[model samples]
Target: MGSVEESPEEFTVLVTGFAPFKSEYPVNPSWEIASRLPEYLPRKDSSSSTLPRVRIVVYPEPVRVNYQTVRKLIPTLWGPNDPKINPPPGDTDAGRSFVPPAKIDLLLHIGMAGPRLHYALERVGRRDGYNLRDVDDQLLGDTAADRADPNWVWYGVPAALESDLDLDDVLQRWRAHSTDRDGVNHDLRISVDAGRYLCDFIYTSSLAHLWKQGARRRVAFLHVPAAATPERVAVGQGLVVELVRSLVETEWAARQQAGTDNKTDAKESAAAHVPADGADTVTGKWYRD
Candidate 1:
């Protein structure tokens, strides 16, 4: 009888988007794009069959554009327990709890970039230098005082943290996969600054959480134009799907290379211990014995 072959593992991604910043922008494009994502990533082509199944689990509600709200919510999203965000009023699933996947392999946070025409993948999450007030008219606190305070949320955390995913490799894959699709030219690039707004605050909080846990910072922040038009939302959604695919592909390739290197090192180590004549020098016996 022939042995059975196991299917590839499924990669689970947790996505979140912030609520509207102010009355001027009634609709936040970030949540619009994130909420519209399909449960599973759409296949690019038949050749992608070998890639692991990608499951996208978007947070149930739009995260409030408040500093305190995000600070309290980061742990709930990344911790072992199920998410604790309350469902928005009139939600159909209000009675039943919305439980995300048991294990989340990646986190993607989306935010609005006011007046910007292009999309940007943030490279760094800054812990200090936040001066903007949240929608609720709250500040993260004086940067100097917060750093000096022992009980502050970011007291001991690093001033900046970057994602563990390789941005250069992911960008290359993203450009290749998202090129000229639907005859729409998408502008995507990596940015070192996240504007020190709630976007940066949330990004820093997520990265710091993982840092404290001694875990890989598999987190990404995407800043998209504030346009909430149906056309813009659709385009944003497409870009997000491709970005997720790029991330998964890059990580998969890296793991494969690491495994190959380990095998080669093992072979070289074994060969070194064996004498040139294939005899064990310590026992004067054949290596096969």
Candidate 2:
């Protein structure tokens, strides 16, 4: 396969951040980081030889931190794959046809972890129940004892879904250039526990949706430290953006190579079974002259 050119190619990515949940802090770090991502992403100029043209749409999901809300919104944000159903974000006027944009190439979900010093690239989201309470002192999950919420997101899903992201690649890029306000390198590590709360709930639901649609090289969840100060939040945002860009470029190149190789293999296989001159073409089988 030939090398993937560095020319400009447009790719759409959907990044989502949850609202302030049980935390006491007035501002949610997850939403803050997502709101500022567009400023850091590369912009397209007139020069056609520029880097990949990335159009990132940051959608802030303001749904309440509850099992019912998460369950309903997942399909809304990610439109249905079945042909009979209309696309999402707008399904008004049943007879009128409206096709939503293509399925996002990458879906990166960000949620704020507890007050910590480093960011975590979450590896697994468990299916166990969340029995915690939100800031309002209400139950966050819908277990048998809690209430009869019939539409739980992880109702019949697997026990756990390990992230398909290349964590090693994300970590390598983060360690190479990430730093804090004090010039101290930030600690970025692979984390197995995504917390048995809404974070895990949403992450697991995302993976399940993508899997059902057969979307590859697509989903990842990032846990950002609860940055207290504005400067700290800025630093965390920059690191996260850099890591995302690296992953996107790497995946893009890989897909290009895979496509080229598949075409080449198909051509070779076709030639190998082709009939020679003056062969028995009527039988639809290859024969020597």
Candidate 3:
């Protein structure tokens, strides 16, 4: 009989971007870049079977830039548990049905950064201090009000939650995979603050949801420049592709290390239970018994 080999597991990433932020920004580059992503990660070594098959699943619609809309939408994206929030309807124009992924290896939310000229991977997601109004001119509630409101959605959640992913390792891998274009080296950075806007709100919501569920905080938020030009959008897309690749690679490496450590610990634990050369066993049996 011939030997059989199992295929590599697939790593699924769910990405989302917000809609235009009011009339001033008629076109949001975040959505422009996300909507154009390829279904799968473009691997440099496509023939390598050991590498996980990275699947890129972008949310069907540009998330409305409304605080309430986002607060309702985050849970649905994570799972189909919320009866109040329903899945997006099928796209009649595209002639295809949109089904959300049951399991996501990583949830990546991309939002526009008006003043930033470089790409940033936010390390922290704040639950409070959102004073700015969303596109609908509504506040998420002041810090005091949120804390005082017993019915507040984020009442029990922490003020800030950081992603569990190793940001330092991810950044290194991202930079290595990314290339300079148009005489500009893509300046990738790690940001502690995600800005107290819809970006931070959405990020915090994702982290808190996973926390409440006792799940791994496998989430990330990327901040891209405000420029929505075709050229800029293309660059953003490239950065996102590389960023996804880095995230997957780093996580896989961490898992591999953890598995190794667990095996070593198991061996040590087993050795500790073994009887010494002359010691009697619990069953009253020994080498010379």
Candidate 4:
């Protein structure tokens, strides 16, 4: 077996939000939450070890908000090994030296929705035709397969992909600790629909990409209902932070366990004098939740 690389003291997460697409909605609540989450998220692990950096990407433009954008975005989150995808600008925490690129383990995208006081945890995103239009009256990616890429045509890929998240666990975690100012219980809904617009377009494409990569990475998109009141904002913020924290902690713990298991397996194999194969005995290849 090759040398085992120890787990880093910090683990990274990438959170993203879209910019305002229409004038009627001046502020995207999703952006508001994404912009503020890092401050509220846990910066340390359960053992008080330093947590990895949280990279934030806020797309300021609404143009081409579809699969193509996400195809480009994926490499950035994962760090661009391919030159075609330019990594976003480097981020630096205040007073700290320039931080190196983050090794992302979990990813979350936030988008705004209408006047419902609930979160829609999308179960699946479909590529089936909808002919729905976006803020600019453009046909959503629901029907256009190759609109994002002029040179490539997509024909045989699955029409839909399920979100790789145990949303029930996320909802349960949120309910355990979160409550609205009105004393009414906040609600979470699991649905197949992601609006069949840019939201679904991005979500489906993002998850498909991550799924192809591996199970070690988790991806999900959240639809935040319109937050017109201070109470709503507070609840939304709390919900987002808790869910994110829970997911990150859970992923980190699994990685640690896999590391331990790999070490034990390697020792056992060596004691038994097993012939070595061309494999990293200390590096687990897959994880799921």
Candidate 5:
């Protein structure tokens, strides 16, 4: 590979947040963080870069996190390898690979979810004026649920990615927003199924796409607390910066390795396809009927 190619090139990272879950003002910290990812991963200059560098995308929060919807939207956002079926590239440089490299690619999922199950984070990580009561009101409004409305939101995505699967190699380590307290991992209640919620849909959808393409890097989803105050939002934003930096660095490194390996494999495969110098046609090369 050329020296230029070796340098960190513009890879794509998709950062997403959600809209109102049911009907709420949305103090969603994950959404808050997702909304500001572009700001967190800023360029050298003061202004924002107008390129498809590191993309920050936000998906609408459906009333219910339908599994089929997840199946639909993943392909919807990132689109399929076949250009004809998917929506047009939003940016001019979207499909075009970066030259000198505009940015590193990342796919992030962040959202505010209720703890309905065992793997729920005890701390909602909310500042003043924010509490279960408030978030409850926001989500449930006047509706009442006794002890049993499924509120446990599991985004053990961090855990899910690390595990090895037979279908495709996974993107294990991802950069994510940093927290002031290193209290996330320990006593960590881990759960695999985030239910059939939108989060699950998005996560599974992304994984399916990357896996199908044999994409080297993996997708990570972050579930944040519903921030109540502006201060908490600021804190959330800081964490987002940390997460973005961490995930981007990890992904960039992984992608570089993947690209290298892919090229090496291609070369080897090409050799197999090539025939003797005097031969006119061979295997795997283009053939006209």
Candidate 6:
């Protein structure tokens, strides 16, 4: 535990889990859902104060291997990303020494199957709409969306990636593990085939590290089951810490509403690319909702 450096306001979320290739009492459920995610998080400070920091960096279980061996399996939880932790530097205004040389945005990848989950925990087959063309393949798609079905996949934040927190006060603080609305996981339903293996090798290799290694930071993949008894693996590890905090607060409120609609379409395309007195004020507001 030495190289601890990261900041971009404080981030990192690469949780992963999966190892018993075919089970035999090896404690699975995606390492109890990446050991319950929550190193710290408060946000709000720009003098607006409330701060708290330590955004998140819960590791353990990307087993069938390779995330550049994730800094050789947790290099003090990896780092590199800190645009001066909001004015944090030289000495110590301290957002933990504003380091962040790599922020480490996202990479979920959880696992556990028994009823029917195929497509890439190295079983191959879910190419394009999120990868798995290898690792043994298996995600033939179509497993029925319906989690109220607003949307399910498509990321981009830096692979891509936030905070205030609300939405039904955060889905009633964990819709009881989508256990069909709290019957205590209604006997754990099983049938998730998203494909490629470690949940499609952590969502098609973190979107192949942003369309393939350019990894700018967002990545995902999840699958869970096997707790009918065995004392319900601590009720499936308290509903996998409320489904990994509702999948990181539903992707941090869709990347803060797509970064406020791309900064209101880049300030109306820089005021329609400059004009007013110089000759360029053309207007055409055509929003249809």
Looking at candidate 6, the ten consecutive residues that score lowest on lDDT are 157-166
For 1-289, candidate 4 gives per-residue lDDT tens digits of 1111223644555566765665776777776776666533554335424345433333332223444555455555554444665644322231022222345556777888866767866656665565666555655343354645645333444566665444545555455545522355767655556776777776766666655555432667888987635666667777777667656555555456669787421112222322122211222311111
Tell me which of candidates 1 and 5 scores higher on TM-score: 1
Model 3 per-residue lDDT tens digits across residues 1-289: 1111223477888898888985767899899999999889887654335568888888777878778778877777787545675754322322124455777888999999885688888877887678998887888765676776877777777777767677667787778778632345677887766788999888999998998877778899999999999999998998898899888887777677779787421112222343322222335421111
Candidate 4 residues lying further than 4 Å off, grouped into runs, are 1-7, 22-24, 43-71, 87-101, 140-156, 179-184, 214-217, 229-231, 253-289
Please, what is the TM-score per model? 0.80, 0.70, 0.80, 0.66, 0.49, 0.26
Per residue, candidate 2 scores C-alpha lDDT tens digits across 177-217 of: 45422366667776667887878877877787766665552
Model 1 is weakest, by summed lDDT over 10 consecutive residues, at 264-273
After the best TM-score superposition of candidate 3, give how far the Cα of residue 50 lies from its true spot, in angstroms.
3.1
Candidates 4 and 6, the one with greater lDDT: 4
Best by TM-score: 1
Model 5: how far residue 145 lies from native, Å: 33
Model 5 score (lDDT): 0.40
In model 2, which regions exceed 4 Å deviation? 1-8, 43-51, 61-63, 80-101, 135-156, 177-184, 260-289
Off by more than 4 A, model 3: 1-8, 46-49, 81-97, 142-151, 180-184, 263-289
**lDDT by residue for model 5 over 48-142, one digit each (tens)?**
24322454433333212333333444554554344544442222233222121123245666656563211121111111111122212332221
- Cand. 5 TM to true fold: 0.49
Write candidate 1's Cα lDDT for 160-266 as tens digits: 77787766667777877888456555777777678889998889899998888778788899999999999989989999998989888877676677697864211
- Per-candidate Cα lDDT values, in order, are 0.75, 0.60, 0.75, 0.55, 0.40, 0.40
Off by over 4 Å in 1: 1-8, 82-96, 142-145, 148-150, 263-289
- Candidate 4 weakest ten by summed lDDT: 279-288
Q: Which model, 2 or 3, shows the larger TM-score?
A: 3
- Candidate 4, residue 30: the lDDT equals 78
lDDT (C-alpha) at residue 8 in model 2: 35
